[model samples]
Target: MSEYKATYLVVGGGIAGVTCVESLAILHPEESLIILTASSLIKNVSNVSFYAKTIVKFDVHDTEATSLHKIHPNLNIVYDSLKHLDTTNKVAVTESGIQINYNLVCICTGGIPRLISDSRKCKRILGIRDTESVQEFQEKLKNGRKMVIVGNGGIASEIVHATRGIQKIWVIRDDYISATFVDPGAAEFLQDTLKSNIEKNDSPVLRRHIFSEEDTLVSLNKNLKSAALGPDWYRKLENTRNETGEQELEIIYKVEVESVIEREDTEFPLDVKLSNGKTVQCDFVISATGVEPAVSFTWDIEPKFGKDGGLAVNELQQTSIKDVFAAGDVACASWEHAPHWFQLRLWTQARQMGSMAAKAMHSKITNEEVLQDFCFELFTHCTNLFGYRVVLLGKYNGQGLDQNYEILLRMTRGHEYIKFVLKDGRLQGAILIGETDLEEMCENLILDQIDLTLFGDDILNPDIDIDDYFD
Candidate 1:
């Protein structure tokens, strides 16, 4: 075993891991650090792999930005996997038999798709984890064939819509779609959108939905456990449907594959056995089932929790073990107020946790100061779904409800939904879909900690203008 030591052993080179290491080096230039990753740096990213894709969010992204990183002498990407973590000994072992001793270890590996071993008849399926996969699917789609997408989250829906014109079926585990993220009212609107699309030849419906279990499914928060496909994926269903009783492919939901057998003499199609006790033939099976943090860690310590199990910590985002800290998608956090759920997920929370943890670790700041700076809304998560910018602030729908915050909501533009929770006139949390003006409000409520109770009943009205609050 090769033994090494560093002040910080930053495991996983994803966003949170990257941010944390960069902050550490800048803050404490004297500290030695090492970064671990399963693959080499995302330099030679191709159009077919999923790990590295050019995020097209930037207009005319200078693709040359990665070239500059290639020359960074200190930028070391350890091509190794975390085999074991001994939080008690403050040591971690990698797949390559490298044992590392550390004062602090951070895990920011991000996530992996909940996989299905069974292929059934779907052969050419892939998850839309990154740009390479999407571009690859795009190329294959040009040839035109039937494809079945499993699961009904944003990724599954996005891919379904992106490949709609080329024949597609949305395989949902439950009836309808989106059961986890959006509200019921929004879901109703989404259903109407799908219905309208099908009527106007904008999309096609193979059937209402397929179910793995019985008619009704229960969610912890009564939110849709699933229903409503984003416009991008379902709208394409219209193009693939035949109006004149032509042969049709299948789009199943709520059904699990009991078995998947490899097909002979073809690079495509997996023989899939369904949970419904039926066999279906599919050319491709894309699984968007869900994701778990890609934590390649197993620790033996008094730390009370592993990667899948969230960590228990105070506002400081410190783990059960002290001197040893955690943040991003690995640690758990709770507050004295309402909706106090330990979280180790989401990009916004990851960044905020990284910043807070960095401050807490520095000898300069006091714990009280760090705790005071810790606010739940600092964990603001936003995403672009089906051309709509949706932002979720704080913990809203979950098993744990903290009475410290209140829920405020309104109908934004058409299908867009907006909701915010306040505590003592100050904004604690919010969720806004579509054009609810999140860019402006998120900054105010989170950064300024403004008391908005003065907005009065106008808060219920979406017509209320937002420009006055900027100052």
Candidate 2:
């Protein structure tokens, strides 16, 4: 096996790994950095701008790993799959027999979609994670009339919203939709858009390539799992309804999958038995059942792991094993997180953690005191659901605040929905749907912790400009 040396090394070419290597390159231009990724395409964060303190906007580009040479000269992208990592000696071995010894290493392997059933065992069920999975789904969806979706996260939510003219039966374990992001009220508001009778012809969905695709999927060893799809992966694809009939969408709430039986007797290929005592016979099944971190590389040196199975890292993003660090979905923060900042495996957090981990490593190398990033002060996310703009800040849905919080909500049927969570007259969280233009204001409110007891119910009044009132 040929051995190489690198000053900084990153594994997994998703947003987290790319961000870490880029930051390292920028921070120490003289040093050489290497990235080992399984996928041919690497996700890079571009057009970055901080709209607010923690609220930032950026576009994710899935570029060919080879083309990354144009972005940074010192940074090198290696198209190889990692087989084992030896944190004891600070060395990593790839499946191709290329060994690398690095002074500092960061694992950004991200996570893989946790399917309801094992992929190898079930040919009829597939989990949406990469372009290839989506392609497979599209081919099956072409002739599919009835489909079953298992899970209620972002991927499942997007899949249900984008697909049309097909009988979609969403199997959710929660009573409300989008249990990961929105509250029951917001779910209800967004659920209306999925109605078959609702006319949504005026707005055309934009389907364009955000990044230059130079390479296709590469054949990796069975040990290496593919990285999770980045942001806008669903929007870029063509989601059109081909079936012509009374299309219906049914929700089977508060149920779990009991078993998946491949039946040759039925017209459909598979029969899915649910916990609710119903058998769903459909063309195929979609498992967006969430993801577990892809951290098998740590098998050589078992680091402290969190409950979610991610490597446990401190506030500085350092793993229990020295010289080895982790970020993105692969790392779980074990430190006392800020009251508002909680862990969610989102693109924004991946970028933040990656950049922060780079800083932490740089500080260790240079023996400099680095302050923690302020982004951790609050939780912020911007996404769209059913053609509606959505912004979530801080403890948006009262998350950990429990019953100690009071909520103020405002709605403008089919146009906008706003909710603000206040605790002891101080702003705790806020959710804005449909271009409310209040993300910045609410972010500041949550950070500043100003008393809002005086405003009372006028806080969410439609006519009241909350920004001006605060000013």
Candidate 3:
């Protein structure tokens, strides 16, 4: 068995883990740092741009782990999966029998897709998470004519938009699409955009190299779970559109999958039965139904866990165990959250948490005081949906407000949609869809909690330049 020692150790190669290591490398360039990951590829955040105060936009690149060594000479990337964590002794054992002793450790193992119950019994059911799984899905999609997607999150929405020339059945338990991100009004505003077959250039600037044969072999032989796909992951997929330009789509709302039936005599390989007593035959089922925290390694003493099965961490990103911390989807915020801020398992939050965790760890080592990051003061996220730029700020959908908030809406049919949540005449949240370019103003309003009752409904009037008025 090989023995290694590091002043700082990080687990996982996703955005959170990589960000944490990068921050640590900058903070302690002379100290020995190690990153243990299952896959040889690591997610790197580049070309970062910040909008307003907290909304961040960045390009995610999957690069070879060896590349990081060149950038940070003090850092080492180990291709191994964590098997055990002895918190008492400050030791970690890998599946390859390599043991590492570390002064501080940060776990950012990320999450795995939460597939439907019948996924284990059926070969036609698939969950898209990592690069390997995405490749498998693309290959399978090439031969598939009809597919059923079960989920209402970003993954499902991306898949629905990226696929063409094939029949699609989108099954959701909510009445509206994208319930995870937007309210019903926003969803309705996007209905036409979703139905339009007009293709738009939605590809992001990808700064990654082509996979080599060695990379393929390593991916195939990997025993530990691969890291979750990062932002705009679907854009990398090869569209399996045939020569026919005709596209077919059907959406079944307010229903859940009751069971999956396989038949040898049917033309379609599987039949999906819904809770509404309807059955749909499809070539395969794609489960984009969210994810559960991936905590594969066992510890001498388990850390506190949240309801979502994630390691519960306080404002400083410290777990219950000493000298151990967690971030990303694997870490749930257990501290007193800001009134408008909440936890969501998104790439933006992952990066924020990762950087914050590194700061906390450094503070602990230096015996310095550290405060929670300001990014957690108000939730902010930006993404593209159906070729439209969507910006969500604070309590965008009036989450946790319990009907005490008033809504102000402005819609221009196909052009733009804006919605605001106000409580006690104070701006609480806002959602701007399309090229509204109001993210900066809205973010300021939410953070300032300015009273807008005087403005009344004229706040969203298109003729008035609210930015200047507010100024």
Candidate 4:
């Protein structure tokens, strides 16, 4: 057993943990900062660009954990899994029997893939989350003739678009695809693009860089899970295909996977029973249902958890436990949220929360007043779906708003789709699909709360030049 001490400790090597430690190193270079992570690889965010006040675009790189030490001499990276957190004593014990004493600690362990109920019973059921699991899925896909994907989230969508020359059976409980992010109209618009991509058999040409010895070492520990893969993780994977150049996709809507039964005679080897009384025979099933917070370590005093099974946190990212905080997917914002802002477990929120938590922690230590981050005032996200850039601002899907709210839409079929949610003639939310380039304008409108009752539906008119009109 060994003992170490730090002024600040952060757990997990994902975006949130890295961001927190990096921010701390920048803010307090004289203080000792330690990051203990289960994974040897850390997610590094670079080339960051803000599309709006809160909307951001950046590149995520899975680099060696030691690379951070090189950048911040005050930051120490420890490769170990958290076994216990003695919050009362301000100490953390690792699975390897190493103990860390800290003045303050932040948990950004992220989340684990929410597997199907019967996932443990069958080896054919795979849940894609970390690097190792994705590699396992890729290996299985090489010989897989058919696959059943069970989810309607971003992960499922990415898998559907990335794989080629294989028959894909997409099973979803929702009527429309990508229900988690977009509305029905946007979902409908994306259908053509999804089909076109499948027909074209477009495959990602980029390949992941070779893994280092440290990365391989972390993967060997099956019990210790790494951080969730980044947004563009699918691009780095090999585009597996079958012997024939035929790629087919079948979407089973409004159904759930009831059970998975092992087949004795069929070549597929597994039979998937659906809630809609349909059975699918496929080589494997990908469970992209979602994720649960990765809070496996025990604590002296258990922290409050939200309905989503994440550590409940206040506006300052502080958990109920004293001197303890949480960020990223493992954290649930229990405080009253801004009207247009809500929490979503994405890399964007993880980075924002991590950076905010660092400032909050610094304030707590220095007894300095700190305000909540401006990023929390509005909800913004930038992602790509079906090869089209998708930007979501505010209540993009009109979430939480009553039926009194109105919607204005302007769609160009296969080219672009724009939707605006209005309440009392003010821009409450907006969704911009394709290369609309209206993100900044729409975001400003939502934030400014400028009334446009007089403009009416002409707000979306292409010839009107709303940007100039607003100016």
Task: Tell me the alpha-carbon RMSD of every candidate.
Answer: 8.6, 8.6, 9.5, 9.2
In candidate 3, which residue pairs clash?
A: none
Worst 10 residues of 3 by lDDT: 217-226
After TM-score superposition, what is the CA distance of residue 176 in candidate 3 from its true location, in Å? 0.8
**Candidate 4 ranges beyond 4 A from true positions:** 197-228, 240-246
lDDT of 3: 0.83
Instruction: Write the residue-wise lDDT of candidate 3 on 1-471 in tens digits.
Output: 899999899999999999999898887788889999999998899888887779888878889988888758978788999999999999999999999999999999999888987999998999988777888899877888899999887778778877877789999987788777777777887776665553454322211122222332111111112124566788877864646544478999989998998989999989999999999999999988888899988999988998778899999899999999999989988999999898888888899999999999888888899899999999898887766778889877666664456777887667778888788788888888888888888988989888888987778877778899766
**Tens digits of lDDT, candidate 4, 1-471:** 888899999999999999999898888778899999988888999889888778897878888988887757877778899999999899999999999999999999999888887899898899988777888988877878899998887778888887887789999887788877787778887887655443343331211121222332111121211225566778766854544544489999989999999988987888999998989899999998777899999988988998778999999999999999999999999999999998888888999999999999898888899999999999998888877888989987666664456778887767788888888788888888988879889988999999999987678877777889766
Worst 10 residues of 1 by lDDT: 51-60
TM-score of 1: 0.68
| Model 2 lDDT per residue over 136-187, tens place | 8888777788889988777788788877667899998778887777777778
Score every model by TM-score: 0.68, 0.90, 0.92, 0.92
For model 1, how does the per-residue alpha-carbon lDDT over 1-471 read when each residue is reduced to its tens digit? 677787776776544555566666566666666767665542121222111011111111112223323333343446688988887788889988988887777666656556566422344656554435555556666655666667766666556433444556666665655545554444444444333333332321111111121223212233222211111222323343334433233557678766666577664455567888876555666767655545456668656554355455456656677666666655555445323222435444555566566656654222334453434534444544555556655443322333333545555223566655556666555556675545455545545667777875465454555656554
Q: Which ten residues in a row have the lowest lDDT in candidate 2?
A: 211-220
